[model samples]
Target: MSVLPLVFTSGWASGINAYAVVLLLGVFGATGLTDEVPASLQRTDVLIVAAVLFLCEAVADKIPYVDTVWDTAHTVIRPVAGGVVGALLAGQSGSLSDITAGVVGGSTALASHFVKAGTRMAVNTSPEPFSNIVLSTAEDLGVAGIVTFAVFHPTAAAIIAAVLLATGLAVLVFLWSRIRRFLRRRAQRREEKRLADGGRIPGRAGPPPW
Candidate 1:
């Protein structure tokens, strides 16, 4: 059977999000977007992942073009999450089950991550460094929580993950809007400065115009 439903329903991931982190990267261990998940809202492990990803995204924004750069680098890291999840599931089953779970989980995570990353790149310009960072930190916290709760409260893990993921996404959208406004204002100021400097005129008697 699929540990995914187990993981997803068992406080691992939500539906679409389940496909991203738990199914692709965490399950398959691949390193491509075709193997990741969408950036959509999630309720389980996917939510936790969203939080982590949001942080990664924030870091990427801080570095100018590093958002894309982070996306590229994460190809490797994405699958690793899948592997970890698979290993966890396999422990509950037999040896063969573990290996299978690893592959499937990694694959799912990859697909989900790819979709999420692609969407973010397509929509935004530059990056909102601080907001993304906060988003990512939230994700890290969610992941840690899931791991801790998997033993005692599997279902709660899913609920917690969903809550964390949704919160991150909402925060991201909010930050995105604010950042855009800030950038536009900054651009306007720069342009005005340029125009003012260029328009400076000197008296004919003067030798040089500053």
Candidate 2:
């Protein structure tokens, strides 16, 4: 969907160009600092795209004001774009089709933006001005690339666009597992300490005092 639109607006050539930039940054930008996604996906092109998007987000997010600002700007742009594209492409598909397209597109775009925004909060450990500006500029270029290429060369662009969508899902799954483990450990410790201190339930004690 994203690649299709990007190709539509940018010219097919622009779409491919956009896809390449995202792939380069996403696949090789960083390793574990963000998420540990493979450079390429198995079957889905979106996985590769998500990897790049995630990587681009990871890099942009590390900056203080940069990531926040970029997300804010895109919130309005990404969704409307999604809606417009959906409406146009779903010709004769009726209102439901447009609505469905809008919903899916908007959701995907918002999630991608959210991950990018959230990462910056943790990455602001380095207060370097140059790095911040560089990252922000790169992201700006990424958006432009997608927008430009959406019209000219959709097939190539579509393949590139698919990479990021899948990567985001992988990143979320990885984060969720880590969080679940942490919570479980924390709960077990609390339970152990409570039992050691005889903090058992007054009425539900073992054997019921029989």
Candidate 3:
């Protein structure tokens, strides 16, 4: 069987939560639920590390600005992880070259990462933290479900993943202007508050307050 479906599905999931994807795949592989998973990922140490990191991510991802920081840090990590997983899946089949699988995985992960980051940025514009928490939880659940389903039904899962990816990108595109405007307004408000608090406005000659 072609591992392309698994590669794409896992890549999409990794963008949302790389550690969760690793943890789930490692667990599933260790438990003999899937034969296509890489042997290295099935190691106990790998599973433990993935689980620990996933826990930290789950907590950090619920916080607004903190989640942004987490996402920024994982920008490279997620794509690399996806590529490694893709290569491993291809290795199992011996039909596709690891490099080809890596390219597919990395590219997919990168695209999904942008979508995740953009959506999170927009959500962070809201003052309430509830939305962030809800979104984070939903992402975790979605990754888990998609990964598990992909193991058994890769082709169907890939189609579903493609649709989701398209929808997310479309929504992001449609709201890009609104999100930018909101960010600009937010910056203006912050600047105004700073100025009101005795901060000098830029582009004006201001006597230094001794």
* The candidate that achieves the highest TM-score relative to the unseen native structure: 3
User: Which scores higher on lDDT, 1 or 3?
Assistant: 3
| lDDT assessment of candidate 3 | 0.88
Instruction: Give the runs in model 2 whose Cα sits over 4 Å from its true position.
Output: 1-63, 66-81, 88-96, 168-210
Residue clash pairs of candidate 3: none
Ranking by lDDT: 3, 1, 2
Over the stretch 86-127, how does candidate 1's per-residue lDDT look in tens digits? 556566544336566666556655654554444344334535
Ranking by TM-score: 3, 2, 1
| Residue 152's lDDT in candidate 3 | 95
Candidate 3 stretches with Cα past 4 Å from truth are 182-210
What are the lDDT scores of the predictions, listed in order?
Answer: 0.47, 0.46, 0.88
lDDT of 2 by residue, 102-185 (tens): 554555555555544443333333456565566556555665565434434545555555665456456756566544554465
Point out the higher-scoring one by lDDT: 1 or 2.
Answer: 1
Model 2: residue 26 alpha-carbon error in angstroms: 27
* Winning candidate number (lDDT): 3
